[model samples]
Target chain A: MANTHISYTALPGRSRPYFGVLYLVELVFTFGLLAIGERTRLYLGPDHLLVLRRRFFTETAHRFYFSDIQAITVQRTTNAVTANAVLFLLCALTLGVLGLYPFSGGMILLGDFSFGEELLLILACAGFGLGLALNILLGPACVTELITAVSREPLPCLSRWGTAQRALALLVPRIETAQGVPSPEFLNVQPVLAAYATPAGRLITQPPITHDSGRLHELLFGLYLLMSVSCMIDLTGNWMIKNAFDSLLFMIVLVLSCIALLRQRHSDIPSDIRSLTGFALGFSVLLFYFTRPFTMLHMFWNMPENFDPAILMSSMLNPDDPLYVAYVGTQLAVDLFVGLLGLLGIYRFRRLYRLAQHNAALDTPPPPASNVEEPPAAP
Target chain B: MSTALTAWSGTACPRCGREMERLPSNSVEPRVCPHCKTSFIALLFPAAVQNEFLGRYGEPLREESEAACFYHADKRAETACDRCGRFLCALCAIDTQDKRYCPQCLENGIRSGELPEFQSAYPRHDLLALAVACIPLMLAIPILLIVLPWATDIALGFALGLLLFPAFVTAPASLYLALRFRKTVTHPLGRRAGWFPLTVLLAAGQMVVWAVAIIVFTGSLFSEF
Candidate 1:
């Protein structure tokens, strides 16, 4: 009923750029991968909201009409974000000061910091300082979601507190003009209205669908197993045929993990499992991207005069090579920790899912027992 | 058309769909989700409480002269479908009290995009053109520098002799894409402004860089000769 084709640019909302915490790292490492971060923009129209998301050379636009919108949910999420900022800032300051051991005139740190340690400390300081800057720039994190008749989605690039609030100030007025506020009496009578609308036989309630992510859990666990094992093998890795195989395996595992993550998005996976899986996936991708350039440049920098594949392999993976040992050792440690915990989570999830199934089956008539592989019973 | 499908009694967790502790309408304070511990402020509107009107049942025909419904032979015909002339009972009608159509006609209308109000998604090729104009050159430089080992040595001469292959290839394609989508409308709310020229300019910039590099290399070669 209202004019829908005018930009509401007069709304003085200062939206902060949000580079997703996990993705910010990926962007720095991979560089030019998918134009991530502040590329997601929200344009306010007179009667609709346009969320324009830019990814690489393509753009996706999601539009929501004001008249059709039913609710706006805003969640405060600053605690974790603030905590992370402080942690990064403190770590940066500490590591940076430690790196200044030579310049400190033997005053700050009692023990000697080796050249390698100094280099690592400085890099760590830079990394943490970058993290601190990004966190501050991201502003106080908040999740604001828009719910219409058909879909409920978070507003892209409106994660900051000040921005979302100002945007809402602009939005609520337009929405109010479109949809008038109901009487208090009318608001209280919703339950009675729903009761009256339903026909007699058609109103019978159906059992809620069970949240079964058993197969997905098992699949992810299997991939993690492969990833951990590959990492272990790479601990002593040469640039052999097997190293290529391991690379292929890691690629496969990453792809499958992404698939699993997508599938488990709307499912009722526990929060702990979801958080841990997300972290592990993000860390692995970050590590992969960060290490790849150095490895390439290292190989080219030390290119043999009489180039031979065998000689290159030996040089790249020489027992005395600190680079190989350090990278592989770090990878192994992370893989072992996350992979084992994830496996435990999978086992626990499967056991719980089975228990739920078993309980749900109790209400129905017992079926004849079949020779299926029984999983280890939950304690 | 009806608000019943959109309505829910209490707020559900956005992360996990468990029903959270209910708060008063437009409460300033946040309610933390019991399961996930995510704090939320739900601004419930009047639509949440609005009653839905269900479809009316078709009346049974009592007289012989009464027009029979196409779907239900025993019921009296309520109205004719707008798209097709088939008689429809009250139950068989699609859409709100607005446009009247049979189920088949409504389905066809949605799929054919004849009803623009029902369609929300349409791609913007003009935006794609601009993105194509700039992204490739940025991606090419860092990767080529490292992989080819040509940042600062004698290899720098060789690197200069050969302009970035990605930029050379993409420049023409970007220009073509820009020109093709030059007249396409991008933003619905904004005034008609052309960004294709900007895209063309970016492509031209890449071309100029490639030209400069080529000229320098050729000049160096000719001077050496």
Candidate 2:
């Protein structure tokens, strides 16, 4: 049980390597493969295994690297696995549809990433991410699903009349059953009237008020999934889209990612919160790149009509130009939001870790019972 | 009113005072008087409130769910009988979710030594329950077939295969195991857990793995296929 306790002080130093490795490997491997393929004009097999292997390796590497994550909550693990499987299953089908592209299959139009190779790579990455998510979420998902399912099922025999009535009903079980009416000897009028204020009875009278905070973490999780998927889509499709559209798409993805991170920072997060964090950092680069094009456009839009088109096109943009300044400012703002959200997310996760530790301390058992009662007879 | 005992200035009676501890009482209901061994009325907390108070005050109170013995009316059982609702104290709880018992009765029928006691409630969903749960998965198959095509077929194929696999593998294995041990060998969850999920995982995992593998081994595995 103590192993489940998450200490805030120990969390910050642990996840960095996994994040760094995924980032570096994706950057080098994705761009390197693309460069080689583009320069050589080579088509890997219609089914690319090497690219998929790299992705699997990079993700699996993190399992050992972050094995310190001790107890995975049941609900979270299940949700993660189920959601991941569903998404990957969707992605695989989508790519398989894309495989029909050369055959002029009408289904290929769903995604903008048209190059067979690029489409395949993007799908591979999405699938691997989904798999890792599924593995982590499976154990917890089963528990949550079981608990949630059981909680909703009604117990036919545990009647509202309370245990005392049930006990008496047990004494003359045949007569009561034969009569097809509730036993009168078991009724207690006074306690039933007084039960409105009793703890055991109050549950029947009062509706529980669920604070929205319980759901905020999950909502944030959903948003994270959307942003991550969108970013993957945009990154894969980047070569096919106009620069302006790419920048806009990237910014939207980044902004959405930060918003999710900010919400996660303020909630009682599950372990997958680390995954969300890693995803946010990966998209941050795309966000910054998106802003780069916007900064250039801002300068282009601000230029005087008389200004030479050559000078404007020659350089990225004049740094002192108002348009350039505006573009840079907007980019800076996005960067700052991402950074701030990351910091706050880490801080909240740490607090949660500490709280988990504190709770574990409270569950300590008392020493063994003295003069214990004999075990009761089996019914 | 037992005034003679009160008049003794709270002194312990030499005969039974040590054996009979003075427990708190309620005037509305009856209680045994420590000194007189007689039922008497006194102002005291109600049973429900008394239990709560004892719980707060760190006193051990009776468990609300204590099982009672099937044959013995006076005896309270520690565990529930798997066959009947009777409480089998420590001695009778059974762990079979097989044909012999439903969950409530199964809790009663098993021997205490056979089943592991869980301190924290381990919520169980039996084969029937698991089957009922697959209702959603059952519903999901068509939707997935429509929505997610490529690898879902593989999963759908496996789900179909499970029906045959159990008949082919489980039936034969059960017979083989019975001959050796002279008892049945069955693992319900294990037999099905891997196939459905592993199909989904492998379908998805393969898509990612194979695609990347082919791309990385671009020169080696690159074909128009």
Candidate 3:
């Protein structure tokens, strides 16, 4: 795959300096958020931290509002990032403690083990980790890139022009303002009728247009927002108990990076890349979700009798205790549910990307009546 | 009348049906087609032509003729003749089933078939080549007898022959024919008998070696006792 990494730096309307600043701010804040969320979860033990993580989704759902506020408030605010970063760091530390589990395999204290075996095992783990990360990142990038490429090209993106957009525009002239009018040149109202004319001598018109896009978009964005929030909650709650601030910070940064993805709405981001990223992000969250239960069951519960939980615990909460089992099971169920929801989010993102292309096509201007007329007799 | 002509020639929109002031001919700015009032993009082919390109380029035209076989006049073929366009009808076609073969497919198909009788006159001599390769394996028992002790010598004789016979006759022959002819050859006679020639030669050589090893080893054992 000869793939290009779409740089936000290349968008037409924006300047390089502005984008650079945004990137830096975005990255720092994102990292900080992840760190905080992770730390909080570690301290709070999956349950309490998850409640905090739900805020991110709520924040994302209200991003348009946040964007307006952020655009105004943070426009020149230089000092906010520092305070946020510090808080994020504290949370990340706590979350990190919770993020970590006793290493899944029992402690191997054999000092004289063969070099080859150790080397192979380490190599295997590193390879697996790298592959996991690649799947996490590359999948979404590929989809969005393809969507952008196809949309920017010459072919009309609409599934049906004559029957849908034209009919819709003609029947409900009022709705035309919302859909916006196509350029008159590409849409030859006269020829379209002539091409698929009825037996009647008069021009034929298709019935009123009905686009189900609004409901679809609402459904998708809603699902995505829900899933993302749930995952955030699950991670945060777990991290609060463990005190792993680093993991929390990483998740915070991840949420911020998603803002760049929302730029797809403003500019034409490729659908393939968006889908790929959605799948990757969704799947990574899913992996982390599955890993949590597996880690607790395999690593903590089965740890050597003498192993200390102090390094892993931000609080005195014992996950193996009967009191915590309900919490663990609840978190696991939520994680699974969100993992499934993320898949639905991916589907919605694809559906929306396609709809954007369609709307863009509908937005194209129609061709003139004279141009639609059969070219003057050849001779 | 003159202004209408000027407007049509210069600044008509292809999409939104809006007319615009005609700019200088050399201007690179994209204009809206006046009739449909659609704004066309710059640095791209027109939309209608682009759709045609996507749908039809490199696609087969309906006017293109279907391929026919050489031997079987009635049979319609899919692949074309490498040299000639003549349709080979069913009766005139060679059915190499996986691939359609015309009369000229010999050079490709020859190695896939067995060597002709005229080329190799010594039909039975072919068995000698099998014996030469098998002889070394058959003699493994005698060598083992000399290398090791008398007690295991007889058993080694049978083991060496059994392993050598199949490997020499079956694997090598099948592999060679597959590589050479590309087509698998089947014996019209007893299916195993065609290969049996090679196996028998190899087996006889192995038996001779085994008997010699047994006698030498057993006699030596008696002498030692």
- The candidate that wins on lDDT is 1
Tens-place lDDT digits, model 2, residues A203-307: 223222111132433444344444444444433333324445645755665565566555543233443443445444453563354445534444543554767
Give the number of the best model, judged by TM-score: 1
lDDT of each: 0.61, 0.33, 0.33
lDDT of 3 at A59: 14
Whose DockQ is greatest here?
1
Candidate 2 lDDT at A28 equals: 42
DockQ of each: 0.17, 0.02, 0.01
Q: lDDT tens string, model 1, B153-218?
A: 555544443446667777888899887766654443344446677879989998998899899999
Give the CA lDDT, 0 to 100, for residue A244 in model 3: 56
Across residues B1-225, which tens digit of lDDT does each residue of candidate 3 receive? 011111111133322223455333212233444322233321111121122222211222233264435444345654554434445544334444244444555343444332221121112222233433444443454445333432365667565665455554544553343344322232111122244445455455555655677799899999999
- In model 2, where do residues sit more than 4 Å from their true spots? A1-79, A82-90, A93-97, A105-246, A264-379, B1-225
lDDT score at residue A349, model 2, on the 0-100 scale: 59
Better of 1 and 2 by lDDT: 1
TM-score of chain B of each: 0.57, 0.17, 0.23
Second chain TM-score for model 3: 0.23
